[model samples]
Target: MTRMSKSESRHPVRKFFLFALIAGAVVAVRNAVSDKGGSYDPNEANER
Candidate 1:
């Protein structure tokens, strides 16, 4: 069996933090979109 190096051992922690950051960003964007009457369409020209 191969042994894990010191750097490799921190992969899970790094992934967890990365996932948390992404999740927080998504939540923030979702909240902003929802609070804006939920009518923000990216493909509509009249949205401006």
Candidate 2:
């Protein structure tokens, strides 16, 4: 019973890491797209 409870407690920690990993991936993709200059020129903005 003790071991079962310990293992059950680890489940939430595993889920938290999984969620963090997914969120990090989403942020990375968003940054990459925004930096790619698809619609705006970053150099022009920097010159100002």
Candidate 3:
């Protein structure tokens, strides 16, 4: 049998945070898109 190295250890907490961040970003984008109907305009700002 081979011994495991320190770098080979898995961290569940780290994985959870990474997944949460990606999921949050996706949800935020989805909400933003849905709020403005189905079209997305890069140059159309609320200030202009």
Predicted candidate 3 versus true structure: per-residue lDDT over 1-48, tens digit per residue = 133343334546766888899999998997688577644654454433
- Ranked by TM-score, the better of candidates 1 and 3 is 1
Per-residue error at 42 for model 1, in Å? 18
Cα lDDT tens digits, model 2, 1-48, are 999889868789887888999999988886676676443557654765
Q: Can you rank all candidates by TM-score, best first?
A: 1, 3, 2
- TM of each candidate vs. truth: 0.59, 0.56, 0.57
Off by over 4 Å in 3: 1-8, 39-48
Q: How does model 1 score by TM-score?
A: 0.59
As a TM-score, model 2 comes out at 0.56
**lDDT rank order:** 2, 1, 3
As a whole number from 0 to 100, the lDDT of residue 16 in candidate 2 is 89
- List clashing residue pairs in candidate 2: none
